[model samples]
Every structure is written in structure tokens, then in C-alpha cells.
Target: MDFDKIALEPIRLDEAFFHKLPKVDLHVHLDGSLRLETILDLAIKDKIPLGIETIDDLKAILKPGYRHKSLDDYLKGFDITLKVMQTDEALYRTAYELAQDAAMENIEYMEVRYSPILHTRKKLSLAAILESVLAGLRDANKDFGIESGVIVSGIRNISPAISMRLAELSVAFKNRGVVGFDLAGSEYNFPAKDHLKAFNLILSNNVNVTIHAGEAYGPESIHQALHYCGAHRVGHGTRLREDGDLLNYVNDHRIPLEICLSSNVQTGAVADLEEHPFRFYHDLGLRVTLNTDNRTITDTTMTREYLLAYENFDLLPLDILDLVMGGVKSAFIPYEFKRDSIRRTKDKVKKMLVEEAVKQGVTP
Candidate 1:
């Protein structure tokens, strides 16, 4: 049972193997994951200006890879997607499709996040936008048997007053479908401390809060998210590796880091996959989980992300299983629900591993 040796050995598991593994995605954005065809249809139907007619052209604009110049450049594609997402029907369809896509890859649990205020350009109430997304997810759950919830995000570049409003919106829908509150968007000049009011409001309401920090900025950003804002989890704390004391504090406190590999690289958070801190964080026993921050925008999926980890990081089957379980553990759900979900998913993962071991002529 030399796990390190096994991890170092070349493994031959294919896409099918990863597809069957039960997974959880704690930090996926809804507005950034619209399918290309769906985007085209929506743009045409709503007369949204995409500046691109064909799918190939749209892909070029939206599917920028990991070599992006900076976080700001990487976010340019959202302008097109968000434009078409201002309607109730568009919101429902996008949310429904995101769930269906996650279920197709055996992502049993997920928290899809978006800023409700961003969708209100069409005069739609924040409540209406939230309900539409919830209705779509609820329908997807009934149809596909995938458990899902919503995390309302407040933008960092936006006004703090608006972030406070979004926090209240999240608290208002606490049990209905909203599970957490998050602060997303750009990370450079826009500090998380600026939105302390929103995070405090979310905390006061007994709601879970995760803030985007250390992606574009330094560990001080993450420190503010934890010390000032009281974040329960951290999104893309990639730069935490730069600060030894703070990194140790995060490990000691067992705060989970939502590590979206491809998205991080695409946003210039890391030099490349080889330089990523995922292995560093995991080896240090930090509660780290892999995610596809923007599935469509990054042109990735949960399965693809797992496969990339396997190929790049040389993670063994057990390591991959642990990562999947970490995501479930880091989810913003009730303790009972988290325990039950992990129990069931672990059983399934064990069974899958046994089957794979047998197929590979290895002892289970």
C-alpha cells in the first residue's frame, strides 16, 4: 500500500473512469458557463450584441486559455455572456443546463454562484432573478437526481452598498435554495475589506461566506477575507503559498481553499499547472478541492479537471478520491447533509476503485 509509489506510476484510467466518480464543485460561476449554442440562441433571441455571429468566432472571444495576460483580460468574455443572461428565461435555461452538465459528469452536489444584481439590468427584481435560477436548479434536480444549491456573489469592483444588498438577498433566500454568500469579481485594486459590511451582514444572518482572495493579490487579501470579513471558505487562495505564517494558519484552522486549476492559470494566478500550489497545499494537509471556476468560459468540466490533475500532478486513484471527498466536505451545507453525502459518495468511490483495481489486475 505504497500510495506515493502508486501515484508516481503511470496510470491508464480514461475519461469514463473519471466520469463515474461522484464529485462536488463548491465554486462554479453560473453566468460564465453558458454553452456556446445556448449563447448564440440567446444572443439572437434577445438581440444582444455579441460582436460574433458564428460559434467559432464566439469561442475565440470566450475560450481564452491559460496564457491570459491578467485577471482583467480573462474576464472580458463575461461581458458577452452576461449581456444575454439578463432575462428570467435565460437565467433558468443557463442554470438548468449547468446542473444537467454537472450531473452528466456525476457531480452529485454543487453550489452555482452568480451576482443577482448583475442580472437586474432588465429591471428584473433581485428576488425574481434568484427564484428563476432556483426554479431551474430544482427542475434539474428532479429530472437528473443531482443535489444543488445557489451561492449569491457580491462583486468586488461593484459598490459596497450593492454588495450589502446582495448579502441581504442571499440571507432572504437562506433555506429556499441559497446556501452561501460570496464576494467574486476582480481582485487587484478592489479589496475584500471594502466589502466588510456585506460579509458581516451575511455572518450576522448565520449564512456561510466565502470570499475571492489571493488570486490576483497577495496573502494580505486572503488574510483580510479571513480576519476582517470572517469568510468560512476561500476562493482561489493560490497566493497563500507566498506567506508561510498565513498558510500555516489556514492549515491549522482547516479552512478549505477552492482551487480551480485551469481558471487560475487562465487568470494568470499561476505561471502554469506545473507551478500551481495544489500539490503544495494538499501535501501540507490543507483542505483543498478542485473545481472548474468557469466551465464554458474555460472550456472545461469536472471530469476534465480531474483528468488534468491525474496527468499533470500524477495523483493516484486514492488521491483523486480524497480530493473529491474534500470538495464534499468543504461545501456550504448542513453538517448532517454533508456527513450523509460524504458517507454515500465514499461508498460509491470505494466500489469504483475496487472495480478499477480488478480491471487493472491489482489487488483491491
Candidate 2:
């Protein structure tokens, strides 16, 4: 019962250990995850005029570290990425490479979310954008054997009417690659409740919903996402700890908190990694899942995120396993698929633990 005493024991985890661990990422952004090399190549090929001719300059401009003055500052990097992602080919390649990148780190299942409306600047239709991204994911699955789904996101900074149209698109692609609807964007002034009509439409059509809340704001934003928008999952619910009663409500209801630690710090959601609420939420038995909200922008991988959690929180291998299982349970996939994936992940983790114990000459 004494968590402090348990936390004192060190658990050694290496890159190979995390690379072999089956994981799930429920909150990765498609446009935010294009490869750096891919971005440069696309920029030159498409003549997108990114202003940065070299990759070093690009990294300096885009790959800001795990701390920022504010969320808006962190979001500035998206402008360059989005500029190049305006075409069907760009969208398809980014989605496919995102899946490939996750699969390299042993992410067996992932749900990629992006605002399709953002990709239409090149005169591509909304349906064309969606299908292009889906096509890339489909091809990646065929090649890498990683199961993937799409979550159509409605940006709060955008119009509510546009959100409604995105909700309709999500419904149309429900059983296809698309699995859920999300409300994501700047979380301070743009409240999730403003987009309630889209959530209502999504819910009415029996679709899943997750909202970005409590990252830049506080518990009130999270409350709106849960109470008004009816989110099944909460993206970066970092401020939920401020409201004990609401935290208990989320815990009791088993709402999964998609905790993107690196992105949280980068967006100034939390002061730093040490101040992050992930350990607090996990210790209190909240359903917390790890994710890379933006791989390219944050310059992170699933393995790196798990490693960061291990190093920052001193989470044992078992704790990391629990988070992985929590992510699988919180995924938008069907119940049957969730069960099978959890089982497979558990078996893999068990085998890895035994191997690690044997290597250390310790009794399992």
C-alpha cells in the first residue's frame, strides 16, 4: 500500500526492451508526424517554399524541445508541415510513414487523428483527403502488418459548421479505416462545448468521440469535454488532478486519459516532465494511456515516450505493461479486437519479463 516505498526500487529498461514491447498510440496527429526528410523532399518536390533550404535549419525551426512559452508557440511548427501536406500525395505519404514509424517501435495498433479540412488548401475535396490518408494507412498495414485506424478531428479554431461536416464524414467512414471523431485544436478560448453539435451528431450516429482538453486550460475544459461534448476519451487531460471529485468521476467511469507527456511540456500544458500529472493519475488508478501527440513536431517515438516515462517516473516494467494494456482497452477498435490485442500484448510482455529476469539471473 505504500507507493513511496515501492517507487524506491529501480527497474532497468533498455531500448531493446521497449522496442519489443507491443504498444498502442491513440492520439498521434497525421500532419504533425511527417518525417523530417520527407518534409524536405516534399517541400522541394512540390515547390512548397518552406523558407528553410536545409534540414538542420528545418529541425531548428520545427523541432523545439519539451518546453514552450505557450501552446500557440508550439503550434507554430505545424504551419510548415501543413504547408507541404496540402496535396493528396503528401497526405497519403505522411499517413503511411506515420504508421511505418510507429510500427518500427513495435506499436501494433494506432489511431491517427487529423483535421481533414486543413488539407484542402490545394483544392482537394474533403473526401479525397480522407481517402488519400486512408489509402496510405492501408498500404502501410499491408507492408508492416500494423493495424491502424483514423480519427477525424474537428478543429475548434475552425467553424462549427465545418465541424459538423467532419462529423458527417466520420460517420460515412465509420466501419472503414476511420474509427472515431475528435475535437482538437487550441484549447484555451476555443471550448469543446462550442463544437457540441458535431459531438451530438457523432454520438447520435453511434460513433466514438475524444476531445482535447485540460492541456492548456484547467479542469473546467475537461469537464466540458466530458459533460457537454460526451468524450469517450480525453486527450491530454493534464489538469484533471486539480479537481479531485471530477477525477474520481472520470476514474469511476473509466474514461481513458491520453497522456502525451513530451507534447504536454512542449505546449506548456505542464511546466516540465517532473510536474506532469501522468504519475499522479496512474497512481490514483485513473485509466491513463501514453501517446505521441505529434511525433515530428515533438521529435519523439513510442519507444522514446516509454523510455521517458520510465526515466521520469521510475515506472517499472510492469507499470509500463499496464499502461500499454490501458491504451489497448481505450482504443476505438471493437471489443473483440481489443480483447485479442490485449491478450497478445500481455503474452508478449510476460515473455519479455521472463527473459529479462533470466538474463539478470533473478527469480521470476
Candidate 3:
């Protein structure tokens, strides 16, 4: 079992920075991040025999060793979560609670992804699943004031026809809440090029598209994601750092990489935090955004990710602030909205830093 915890030291910082900082999460999987207590409660209510008697048992199932050996192994965790998310009640609850968790973390905006097909086993139609997720988001919004949207994903290993249907569904619901279409799943055997028709359909319909690329494979996966699949953003594009040309191209285009540091480490996307390509990409001025791919599976949160990155990378407050701004800039929103949001966040972060520096009697 290669379940080594990534070594990390606590980052000593001012309290104000954590509280006042506004952030955005561009990539997160809804079902993959459920609270363990919620999962257990739901399992009991639904009479789903989870075999595990305690939270520790559940944690072991989600640990890296139990996680997929390849891209396939990583995605297998979603199956267990998705099984518990079949009913409209469960789906809505998970989506709403995910939003609540994001709000608690002070995430101002976030986009959640899931494969609608995976949640339809109980004869719940695709529209029904989507509607349930939207209902949860709306419910959470009324309570927490967090902005959220959905990105419907097509399982990459599935038939191309099914992929196209998913893309069409994403297009149909774009105005409703579906902000984009994504190709997710195993990356080695199932390349981005395998779903070109689906991505093309998405593009033709003017639906935003992103692809899970460069996580389990190499730079060619990223190339196909951008060039062949027409992906506007790359998910877990850790392998892009291996190629200087690809890195330059990504920076030149300002394409955002949705980085999941802990998830990457746990899933064997990289050897460890020190080996994480996020530092390389950030140093090269790539549009990089930090995220919790699956909070429970990775046993992490956005705040924890920031703290670890800060300590491991020796990142300054301004750099952390810049990363927040980077997430806003990379959001799959309309141009005007993205521009205005980034500008406002940048100004707010600057003011916050200045206030902190004043309190500490140091120039920041």
C-alpha cells in the first residue's frame, strides 16, 4: 500500500487573511465531496448496507490505496458515492450541502460537476437529476448567498453517442444552470479525442466545455483536450508542466488549470506536494486555480489546500491573494462578468493585505 501522507507544516499567518479573503472554486465534483456523516446518515435512511461500521471504515475506502490504480481506480470512488445519490432527495441534499460547505469555506462562487447518467439508476430522468441539483443549489443560495452553477459531465469511456447526448443535455440546460460540458473519467485508455463529437456539439451549441486531461497521462492528453476536444479549460492538467512548449502555449492562451493538489497527491497524479506541478505552473505565470476535487475522498477543504500550499510553497499573502484572483479570472462565466469579478476581488484583496500589513506594522 502506497498511502503516504504528503508532508506539510502549518502555515503561520494573520487571522484576518483567512476570514476576509473571498475565493472561487472552478472545479469540484458534487458527489465526490459529501460529508462522511451525511453519507452514513443517508445510507442508514436508504437502507443501503455500506458494510463499514464506522467513519474510519469509510475513510479507508476513500484512501489512496483503495483508490483506483489508474484513472479507472480514481473514478471508482465516485461509483460508491453515486450509488447513494440515486433518489431526488439524496441528490438534492448532496448538492445543497456541497454548496453549504463551500459557503462555510468563504467560497463566493463555485461550479460543481457530475455525470447525470450515473445518478439516473432509479429511473430518474436526466432532466430530473439536473433539476434536483438546481433545486439544492437554489435552496443553499437562499441560506448562504453563495453563487453556484453546474457542469454536466460525460463519462469518457461511454459510447460517443451517449457522450453527444450528454453534451446536448448540457446545452439545453445552459440557461437553467448547466454552465458547461465536461469529459471526465479514465484518461489513458479514454483520450479526449475519443469524445470529439460530443465536444464539437457542445461548441457548436455555444456551450462551454472543459476536459479532464493531463492527470493520468502526458502532455499529449492536454493537446488533444485543447486542439481536438476544444476544451476551454483543462482539469488536473498537472502533466502539462512536463512540456515546456505546452506550458508556454497554456500561458499564452491564459487557459486556467483547475488544480487539485491533495487530490493529485492522493490519486498518484504526482509523487507528492513537493513534486506537484502547481508550483511550476504558478511560477511560470500560468492561470492556475486551486480546488478540492473531492473533499471527503481527499479528506481536505479549500482552506486546508491553501494552508498547505502556503506552507509547502512558501507562498506570500499577496501570492495567495493572486491565486484567488486567478480563480475568478478563470471562471467559465461571461466575459464582462469574469472581468468585473476579478477586478473587484483583486482590489478587495489588496485592501485586505494593506490592512493586515498596517496592523503588523510592516510593509506588504
Candidate 4:
């Protein structure tokens, strides 16, 4: 139990070790995280025109893990997935499958986010869209033992009035299944302040707020998200380090940044892993948590994200413990829930590391 005295350090750990550790995914997208084969299956079931029948052909077109020229370019992959998600069955199946996949990798908790308006093309009511996905998550919780919640998103590129509508949905489902409200979409020209009405409504209802900022834009976007929109957490804050003053404010406030490594690289948020600010932010004592922003689209998993940190950053067992604990703290759950998770995750990781050290013939 005396972790400080133990020399349990592994900079480059086996991927299987990462898979064995209990994990939390706080920022995965439901629409973009679909399995390619599921997309093809749903497309065939719904008679949607994907022009491809095979998974390999679909992968060649969707181009999972493809490095793109810009954030918008990286997002174009959603156009294909959205085609088959108009029905309740598609939404339910995708949500269940995503949770099942996350559970298989030992993810104990997950929060999936998406815009209901995007799935309304087939005359589905907003409430119905939300319920279908919630049902899938509920079933997955029963079958796979993975707890999950939904974060209804208001698209930044869309109108503020629409964002307000989504905010209302978040409030209506506050204790039912929805945990938080988010502003996600093209953040280039669409500033977070433009969605102030939505955030205002969300805050008035005491709903949690997390906005996508400083990824496709600069630190100024992050500033707007915090100052104007009143975001509790930031998504893909890769550019927050560009402004030292803002970075210090975030650090002092202990605002968690949901950093998605592979997605950041594919979206051109950072040039590459060497250019990523994850190591910089962590070294400065900021609350940074790793996530797979889009699992299938970015071809990443919770296990892969942790491995990226292990290989790219010089992190010790305690540092990895800190990162894992950071995720529990950033979750939108109640404080009492987070306290339990933080304690349990710390104990589990420490015990696992001790065993790993023993396996390597190190003194316990």
C-alpha cells in the first residue's frame, strides 16, 4: 500500500496491461464511434445508399484513422454514418454496440454525446431519439455491466435557437438519463459565445456544461467558452497552452481538459504527438484526462489512448494513476459517486502495478 516507496515505473508498458486496467471514457461521440460493419449492416437493413456492401470497401471510403487537412475535413466521415442513423433501431444498436465495445476493454463508465437534431431526419421526435439511445445504454448496462449516460449536444455551426432547444432537452432529461449539455461542431468560425443563449438556459437549469473549444480555433475560443459560455469542462483544448494566462486560469480552477490524442492528430489540432500539449499541460499540473473522442472514426480505443500516453509521455505509475483519477474527477456524476470511483481506481491501479513489479522480479 506504500506506493511512494515502491519503484513501480514502466514508461512503455504492454498494451495488454492498459487493456486490463479499469477505464472511463468521458468524451466519446455516439454517431462517429459506430463499427464500420455495423454501418454497413444498418445501411443494408434500412436500404440506405452507401454504395458499398462490404466492410473493407466501407473502410476504404470512410478512411478510419486518416490524417486530414483540417478539422472540417476530418469530420466529413460522419456524413456516411449519419445516413443510417435516422431510425430508432440504428440509434439503439449503435449505442449498445459502443457501450459493449467499451466494456470489453474494461471501461467501467462512459458518457456518449451526440446531437438529436441530426437523427431527426426520419421524422423521429426529439424525445424518442433520446429515449432510444438511453434504452440501448440501459440494456448495455444490464448485459455488460458498464454504466453509461448521455450528453445532448448543441451544434456550434447550427443556430442558437436550435441549441436552446437541445438545452431544453438536456434539462428535461436531467435526472432521467442525460448528465450534461455540450456545444460540439465546427469550431473554426462558430464561436462558443454565439451559443450563449443555450448555455444560459443550461446554466439556469443547473445542467452541466462542456463546450468544444481551442481545438480547431485558438486559446481565445477557450476563453469564450469559459468566460462567455460558462463551461465547466473543455473538450479538445489542444490550443489552451498557446495563452499562458488562460492556461494558468484553467490550471488554477482545476478545469479538466478532455484530450483525445489520435483525433487531435487527425484533425490537425496538433501537428503530431511531439507537438501535442498533453505532456506540457500535465507537467504544469493541469487536470487533463485522456479520451477517444471518436472511437471508430479515429480508429482508437480507451486502451490505445492510454498506450499513447505511456509511449509518448515519460509517465510513471503514479502519473498514470493521476491521469486515471483525473477522469473520475471530470465525470459529470455527483461528487459522492466521483469520490468512490477515485478511491476504487487508485486502489486498483496500485494493486495492478505492484503485481506488475512482482512479475518483473522487482522488490515489492
The stretch of ten residues in a row with the least summed lDDT in candidate 1 is 1-10
Off by over 4 Å in 1: 1-11, 64-66
lDDT of model 4, residue 47: 93
Count of clashes in candidate 3? 2
Least lDDT summed over 10 consecutive residues: which range in candidate 4?
Answer: 4-13
What's the C-alpha lDDT at position 138 in model 1? 96
Taking the tens digit of each residue's C-alpha lDDT, what string does model 4 give over 284-347?
9999999999998999999999999888887788788888889988999999888888888889
TM-score, every prediction? 0.96, 0.96, 0.92, 0.98
| 2 against 3, candidate with superior lDDT | 2
lDDT of 1: 0.89
What lDDT tens digits, residue by residue, belong to model 1 across residues 1-364? 4333344344467789888888989889998888889999999999988888999888877774536889998888888889999999999999999999999999999999999998989999999999999999999999999999999999999999999999889889999999999998889899988998888888999999898999999999999999999998999999999999999999999999999999988889998999999998998999999899999888899998988888888787667778988898899889987898888887777677666665676642
The alpha-carbon root-mean-square deviation between model 2 and the true structure, to one decimal in Å, is 2.9
The per-residue C-alpha lDDT of model 3 at residue 217 equals 90
Worst 10 residues of 2 by lDDT: 1-10
Error of 1 at 218 (Å): 0.5
Q: lDDT per prediction?
A: 0.89, 0.88, 0.82, 0.92
Please list the residue runs of candidate 4 whose C-alpha ends up more than 4 Å from where it truly belongs after superposition.
none
For model 4, name the residue pairs that clash: none
lDDT of 2 by residue, 231-313 (tens): 99999999999999999999999999999989998898888889998898999999999999999888888888998998889
Q: Which digits, one per residue and each the tens of the lDDT, describe model 3 over residues 201-225?
A: 8899898888888999999999998
